[model samples]
Target: MSAERTGVQTRITDVAALAGVSIGTASKALNGTGQLRDSTRQRVKDAAEKLGFVGDARARALSSGRTYTVGMITTDSFGRFTIPVLLGAEDALSAGQMAVLLCDTRDDHVREAHYLRSLAARGVDGVIVTGRSADARLPIDVSMPVVYAFTPSTDEADVSITLDDAAGSALVARHVRSLGRQRIAVVTGPERHRSAVRRADGASSVLGSHLVAPPLFGEWSERWGRQAVDVLARQAPDVDAIVCGSDQIARGVCDRLRESGRSVPGDVAVTGFDDWDVMALASRPPLTTVDLRLEELGRVAGQALLALIDGGMAASASVAPTLVIRESTVGA
Candidate 1:
């Protein structure tokens, strides 16, 4: 049935009829909710635009009882890694006209609970939960939609975004192998950390027979890296290459190697991860490392969370590690 336009007023039912969809489906498309096909949504939008349909965008949003704000809750807001994710997320969210409310809970469950309740009371459209690592954790129950970034919720139903650490480590392994360096060893963080374990697993699978020995699971500090050097020396004095789990550990390994009169990428090659500029760029010969694309991770995570808030479907995604070559791996 053709929409009966009484004067210049075009009702929502008119747009619905023009789009050949039910009024509810048209409302979902207009309200930016429901899992409507992209084509269907576009059709509704086109019909609305064609008919010069007029409605208060903000009023329609408010009708759904939404505040048009997203809450980003992080355990470590100032952490080297967390900052990039936040920066990226904020950039994307700002572009989409979504205001972000940041809260640093620092892993304190009580503080976290308070933030959640406060954000819910503020009527935030959704929440993006970011943590220091990608390890799976218990699900958080809340009234609003949530997207996990950096840290993933173990619940299969929850959407998450994280770095592909194993794949990245494999890239590092391949780069070392390409340099004709065998006898590779890894010095990483605590064994219980899922990120460390995944990185080791990836490097080992690719290194195969080239691996000199198993990885040394220690702390994520230069001190541990330096201590690990002695252990590696005892285990394999002729170690030709070392793959550190982080730039800090790599720095310790490189410093110790220099003291031992080992030329980086000459007598012993080294590599690190996270592509931290301060550490990687200042090394005697810059450190080769993996760029986790954390900023991109945040942008993508923000986009995903926006989708969830819009009542659209978003799946768990991962960002790949990019190898950044420097003097540590390839001689200057």
Candidate 2:
């Protein structure tokens, strides 16, 4: 008999009976808990769907002593980076039927503290802290499981999911070298910034003696990229390639290079980090750039947070960067 015909509420036991699994296994599969085979979990889920079964949240909460909700705290007011992370996290958490509460502190310490307290009061199972930059920030003092994303926690013991920036820079350096570009230059953001410094160092490690001049440090803007061309003209007039710290800077460099009568790839190849589509696609010849895979990082962070909530240990890890080849480095 169909559950709708009898107007009887379907239970996990009914789902288990239909799926030929024990009630315990059905419960674990539905709740996204316990160790079960993927096929077993999927079969149980299919049975539950066929039976139109839905678990009672109140009873489940009482049994588990968990609210089944998590908090996502971000300091990125612009949502430029946080949005993708949030989307990926949502995807991961949906499998567990867990809810997420988003809190944006806008880089205000006092505001952040308030959100932390609020999340604790709401009885979130855990929290994921993130920011726009890769610079490490102080760890949150919450008693719940905490996972850091993008911007890591200063404490080494905390779980942090970050991008492999140095490796990404090395990829760009190697690609330009493969194109037979001998004289290369680097242009990036502020010297004090960890991301800029790491990227420059990574490229330098690969280019070595082939690097034409010291990396130019300035703001992360097209204006700085345009200005860098002037400096490179004076220092390495015959430079054949430029590795930029960001897509915006690379676009600017391309613009300035065009103005200076240097044909891209034919005369000088260009590469950028952060495959930001708007900047990379709009550039004259497009940009060959590094994909930070921020969404994947977020998904990993979400999984780590979930593991912590489930009494599993999660270690700090980094996602490898992906090099995207475009017309900027290779002529069309």
Pick the lDDT winner: 2
Give a tens-digit lDDT track for model 2, residues 14-126. Answer: 89999999999999999899999999999999998887787787778778899899999999973777778888888888677789998999999999999999999988899
Give the per-residue lDDT digits (tens) of candidate 1, residues 21-57: 9999998998789999999999999998888785554
Cα RMSD of all models vs. native, in order, equals 7.8, 4.4
Give candidate 2 regions above 4 Å deviation. Answer: 1-47
Which parts of model 1 have CA positions greater than 4 angstroms off? 1-64
lDDT of each: 0.89, 0.92
Candidate closest to the true structure, highest TM-score: 2
Candidate 2: RMSD to truth: 4.4
